[model samples]
Every structure is written in structure tokens, then in C-alpha cells.
Target: MTQTSNRIFDEMARLMNDAAGVAQGVRREFDTLFRAQAEKMLRELEVVSREEFEAVKEMARLAREENEALKARIEALEGKTVAKASKKTKDSEPPTSAPEA
Candidate 1:
């Protein structure tokens, strides 16, 4: 009876050890597969990281503001030029002809 019990105990321990080893291997394989898939997805998406996106957004905003300011300046300059030209035309007009001779 004792021999039978000992054999059974040993068999159980061996099986348990094998199962633990298999579980560890499976965990490692899953981790490796998940990491590879994540990297592939990131590459395929062509998405910038948050920090890079934020930086680009800030640059675009600054460019837009600058463009608007430049446009306003150009409009102001054009208005001044137009006013000066109108004034010059008014000043240069000849007087109406006097009565004949």
C-alpha cells in the first residue's frame, strides 16, 4: 500500500511540474506574439505619437495666425494706395474750358 501511494504521489508531482513548464512557455510565446502584432499595427497605421501631433498642430496654428496678420497688413496698404491715387486724380483734372476766346 505504501509503495502504491508513493508512486501515485511522484506521478502527480511530475505531471504538475510539466504543466507548469508548459504554462510558462505558452505565456512567453503569447507575450512575444502580442508585442510583434502591436509593433506591426503601429507601423501600418502611419499615426504620429501624441507629442509629435501636438507639436505639428501648434506649428500650424502659428502659421495660420501669421498668415492672417500678413493679409490684414496688405489690405491696409492697398487701401492707402487707392486713397492716394484717387486724391491725385482729383487734383490733376484740368479746369473747365472758358467761354470761347
Candidate 2:
């Protein structure tokens, strides 16, 4: 009778262990499925990756800097042209003089 009881208890313990293993496997599969679905959703939304965003941001920054530099150069050239025109006007003007005594 004692040996029979031991065999039954041993079988029960083995069954419980198998059930725990199966539960763990199901949990792992669920996690994998959830991750796959999330990735698919993000792709469908056309979300940019971090690397692509950073690259485009850097390009925009560089373009802004170039535009600013060009604006400064244009202003400097305009100033020089105005100064030259003023100088030419002064040179072309007749000099004023008092009548001789």
C-alpha cells in the first residue's frame, strides 16, 4: 500500500511540472506575437526611424546655415554698391566757390 501511494504522488508531481513548462511556452509565444503586431502597426503608420530623422534634421540645419550665410553676403554686396554710387555722385558734383574780390 505504501509503494502504491508513492507512485501516485510521483505521477502527480511530474504532471504539475509539465503543466508549468507548457504555461511558460504559451507566455513566450504570446510575447512574440504581441511584439510582431506592434512592429507591423508602426510600419503601417510610416513612422520614421530615429536614424532617418536625425539625418534629415542635420541636413535642414546645414541648409539654414547656408541660407544665412548667403543672406549676409548679399547684404554686404548691396552695401558696397550703395557706397560706390554715393562716392561717384560726390565726385561728379561741381565745387562751390566764393566770387573773387
In order of appearance, the predictions have TM-scores of 0.59, 0.71
Best by TM-score: 2
For all candidates in order, the CA lDDT equals 0.97, 0.98
Give the range of the ten consecutive residues with the poorest summed lDDT in model 1.
92-101
User: Candidate 1 regions off by >4 Å?
Assistant: 1-36, 95-101
Model 1 collision count: 0
Runs in model 2 deviating more than 4 A are: 1-17, 98-101
Total backbone collisions for each predicted model? 0, 0
lDDT of 2 at 87: 99
Maximum-lDDT candidate = 2
Model 1 Cα lDDT, one tens digit per residue, 1-90: 999999999999999999999999999999999999998999899878899999999999999999999999999999999999999998
